[model samples]
Target: MSAQRPKILIIGGGFGGLFCARRLAKADVDVTLLDRSAGHLFQPLLYQCATGKLAIGQISRPLREEFAPYPNVKTLLGEAIVLDPDAHTVTVRRPDETEFVIDYDVLVLAAGMRQSYLGHEAFARWAPGMKTLDDALEIRQRIFTAFEIAETLPPGPERASWLTLAVAGGGPTGVELAGQIREVATKTLANEFHSIQPEEARVLLFDGGDRVLKSFAPDLTSRATQALTELGVEMHLGVHVTDVRRDGITVTPKQGGPDQQFAARTVLWTAGVEAVPFARHVAEVLGAPTDRSGRIQVEPDLTVAGHPEIFVIGDLAGREGLPGVAENAMQGGLHAATCIRRDLEGRPRRPYRYRDLGSAAYISHGHALLQLGRVRVSGYLGWLAWGLIHIAFLTGVSNRVSTVATWLASIARPGRFHRAFMLGAADRPEQRYTYSTSDLPAEGHAPGS
Candidate 1:
């Protein structure tokens, strides 16, 4: 560690922190990036991984490999538990149950958001949200296992219940997931089962709102709705889910009509998200103010109100003035980096101004909704644009190639790899103790032991 150079610490390795660290790579400062995971995940493609459309490696890159050439930048794999602004130090807990205290001249908080259970924690037992790679893999296992279970059941209501898939939200993630599940059931798993035809599988997308894709234009939403419906997806709009259990879901329409219960084996929750717990620590430590959602409110420069040295970005920061998208997070990270450089050079800091780059979401095969200024495109052309843009935005060349190859394979064979299943025993901690080296013979030690 060089004492002469100023120390800049960034928390979280998502869009914001990674962008900020990359921008300050050549700057005259010591930059350290810390994240809970060893690899940086491109979250936009998580649904694809969950749906078995892409592998985990195709959407994630190792953090060390990503910043290997930048000697001034160091990476730490840990979870930030506390922030002490007065001492300018952050307390991070490592995976091995050890704590490390790192002091910084300037700190940037970019910890992202997590799934919001919305006071319904019990629903998590049946339906898990898509937030992390583990969550995606678990969901993939659940989905694939449901099909396997359906194969064993007799042809009746039980089979129907096993084949029914429910998505709780109508947002981009939910829509994409519902659409992808429909495609997987119809095209990929069409001929796998003997008793039940995969095409008969029901995919239901439920939303309390009247329309799907509420963020987009009405016409585009209509087109997406139609596209999904054409793909054999059932849309339950304007309905509030009163209860979600393992067997099915009970929903009541907004008009106070009769309660409806739909039998579904797998329910995916993509409704809402709240900032991680660390955001509250940042706020309390720096005395920074936050919005109602517990997201830090930053100034135009991405700095906390009373603390110029402390900056907050990404989903953890509430930019009421700007939209909370991945692009905005990247821009905010760049802005934070620029401000840090300016402060080091004894120059005035510039205000953070966000530029709208538009938004796009894929509904189904060769179909998407794109909004670019006044120009709104839907259908196959929009889907092509979405694919190209995502490929261009991916982090590494290998990831891009892998994603493209998978997409091409899907176009060619549809469901070439959907049959892959988790065959081993489930993860259990007690098994570890049973396989300890102490229980093994000295000359015949097990491979792992």
Candidate 2:
């Protein structure tokens, strides 16, 4: 081995990889962060982008710019199709469809999860998800286009079908999407449309659980339900969406409701998520097990069972009972970096520990729900807290300031949604599979001596 510092490879530009890169900023190590997307998306606020409340640019920052201050850290835009743990190499597929290999002394896997169709992968053709920029843009198109399409159709079920919006899964993403659609129909797009009354649009939220936001406390769930009811969202609880077609969906509600089919042209699927396919590759390469969700069963130190040099953090690791939220990724990334530093210094690596930083969800208009441990706040106060907290969590100073300004402007202006449908032509096209590490101007660092 040459007398150079150890090399680190971090995958996924989400919270885990981003945080892990930051944690190793001043360390005596070389880090290369890879992600398929060019930007590091603030996924929590992605609902806003889908709803036209915030532009995509405001929430996603380029990974290259995010880590420009750290000379030891480099950002590469590409996807990892294969991970060879025994060989300590990752095979990357670039946007151009070519492939290359990069060897590493240590690796951090955090490729994040993708929207799942609950065994109905065919459902994806009709009901797109709210996970990526493409997904958001596609949902936005379907939404606004539905409204526009409704204008021409004569008054009937066809018009109603165009007016209806069905959102699968009553989780945070589903709730936020439903709430925003309600606001648009009742308040934002009220006077703008001519043929069909926007207020007449039907917004449906379906969930398998008896209550929404199941991860939150009971009282908060009750509060959110009440708020959603006031917004005119039809909550179909104890329901399982069995099938999704181009025109509608089939739901089997546990409440003894008949196998009912809801007719709606627009659908958003936020029901479930499985780790990115790369996780399965990692599990296979490591001879490790994975949960039903396809997330790797990582050890206490956020590493594979017997591979101390390889760490799996964030949405890709499932052994820990941590929620797949931003907080988990942030803390888990930090833990991986700390353990790596310890190993480099000839010290024992520590077990990974996660800190529950609480959770919050923005409902609509001036309403929100915030939960910090045992305490729960709802309504406008919670909404205010949500705003402040999200702004604080944004990556950069400029992004934070501009995001606040843009948010305020969006709230003040209702006409913004009128023009969003024109930005993209496709309604949720297939994602591009890409990743890279060779584009860096600097020479690759030799592995640990």
Candidate 3:
């Protein structure tokens, strides 16, 4: 072994990457964390931002600031495009469209997952997925704009269509998003509109699965369904969405029935997610096997089976029928870090054993279902537990305090929806200024010019 410390490169700034970096802070390794975004986003609370319950800045913190205490760690703002495992080099595209290469003795691939439309890319133009801060803000705009448009429509189906909101998927994200929307409509937006009562707005929660919160116990699912129903949300279970378009969505029941079409202005898809493209690149580069979800098949120690030096974690690493949750990603990151640390110190590495911390889903208004092993709690108490646990798990004191204050304010007044929409001048298609990390014009250049 060389006398110099090994250089470690982590490809993500999510839960997995963040945890691994923190764990290896004191180790004799040079750590470099790379991500396209400048800050670390608390993903679980992204739905709140979409619903205007929280702002985008409230749920994110600067990545450099978070890792500043550890002098051995460095943050790079760039997107990794190619990973040459044989050469131990990573090629990344900087914001200036320049490619940079970094040599790494150890690499952790945790690029994470992105929204999967299942071969329906066209649907993205109308119904956006909640993944990044921009996505959340765009959805928030669509939601608030729906109400704004409804105020001008005559009282009829046209108005109802404008007030209607449809959410596809019944997983934790969809459930939490639907619940937050219900609260916003019934509470925050109750008296805001003149021609319509936001409380009567139609919020549809659709799931192809047989029930919501499928990962939870059956009893908990039943309770969640009941709570959502009480909150006036129309639950469509076991229904496959046939088509999603700008107008609406068409669905067919799983039991073989007539197709049902609903006309709505806002449609949100949280149904499925697939591993980011980097995972496939890694698998192809290493000639390693991967599962159907495009996640690399790693060993028990969270390292690539054939190439032990390369580690894969988070949603990009596949385990047999394992649910890709934040907890799983964190555990995988820690395991990979531990393995690397042990190898460096000439110690035996421990296999990763996932501990099920249970699952919780927030249902309508102030109710929730929590399953902690044999213990299951429902209703208000469960909601309290859920809030406390989430608050505790949130990173940084500013985010925690801001989230708590937002929750308390929502509970106290419940009609204060922060409206900060700025409508700019209209422009032609060619003149439209689209904002994205990958595509931005030069500092002084006009969008169209």
Candidate 4:
């Protein structure tokens, strides 16, 4: 609506938002990119950072630095709290909770999803999900600190509890986290400590599905299972994590059976994800239909019904056959950009057609799985392809180079140079949980039968 160049407002700096902005970098438009976080996280490799295989800097790039070359793109740090589609304005809350307004002619909602606790939000204190930089750091701290705590305790149940790690999810994130933890225990910290054998640590992976990596073919899943088993990861499939506490988790069979309790000090959650809070608010204001997970249903052109100026993409877009993956998000972003360009030129906009680029998952050291159409590759060959695909998709040349260097060094030796983690309020026991001591399970025994 501006007499000047059209004002384009993009909410989020993830794959979708970033790609859209980059495509419009030289366009005759003023772009405002807003995100709650300063850096654009490379989420696929978040587990690597959590397990110390890569540094946070290697997996994330600051938005300011990323957009320094794009004169038309102005990046701001804020969380979009309210949407006024009718007025073409959005209210954003700053880091200090102060509110401001942003006006736009065209809006792009690429704000991605957040870790979902399903229905139990209280489980968050005990189980940290793999979604953000803070989550990665928190998991890293828990992992390394658990090892250190185990070293101090003599051979006993408490030490074993500290050495036990649990991951709740069979998806790519869960599988990657489980495998990386085992690899870290058996390889990186195997001989680093004299008090206890780090290789003896137990990593339990739990999922309600019958097998891990259910997105892949049965053979690929079988190969992943074998690789995980060989890496010393105990797979507990066909079970649901019913309850989580400060000390352990209770798993009940999905087919209805007695519950089994596992004492684990560190639990990483990658079970599910839902739209971020802002995305939900946007959906409400726009009267858009969303799937169960809060993904807004969009027209074929990635626009809301009766609101073609507003585009929704990435994990937040609910469309048939549109997988919530980085490749899909990137392509969606470009499509949205192309639509906007076409609109400016008075040309008819085309519907978005998502191209499936397949999927890849890293299992362990020198092992991975890659599937594209009928082409299924596993083991060393698959690992190489997986690495190439990731490296090519990673943003920025510096990040790609550093990540490759780090990977090569890690492969050549057992040393993990980025193992350092911080301990702040996490060091305090009283600040951990709101529940009283009476809420804990009986000593030496779990609560459920």
Better of 2 and 4 by lDDT: 4
lDDT of each: 0.84, 0.84, 0.82, 0.90
Off by over 4 Å in 4: 1-3, 425-449
- Cα error of candidate 4 at position 249, Å: 0.4
TM-score of each: 0.92, 0.92, 0.92, 0.95
Best by TM-score: 4
Q: On lDDT, who's better, 1 or 4?
A: 4
Model 2 Cα lDDT, one tens digit per residue, 390-412:
89888878899988887676556
Could you tell me which 10 consecutive residues in candidate 2 have the lowest summed lDDT?
432-441
260, model 1: CA deviation in Å? Answer: 2.3
Worst 10 residues of 3 by lDDT: 431-440
Which of 3 and 4 is the better model by TM-score?
A: 4
Per-residue lDDT tens digits for candidate 4, residues 278-298, read 999988988899899999999
- Deviation from native of the Cα of residue 353 in model 2, angstroms: 1.5
- Candidate 3 has an lDDT of 0.82
Q: For residue 150, give model 1's deviation from the true position in Å.
A: 0.4
The true-versus-predicted C-alpha distance at residue 142 of model 4, in Å, is 0.6
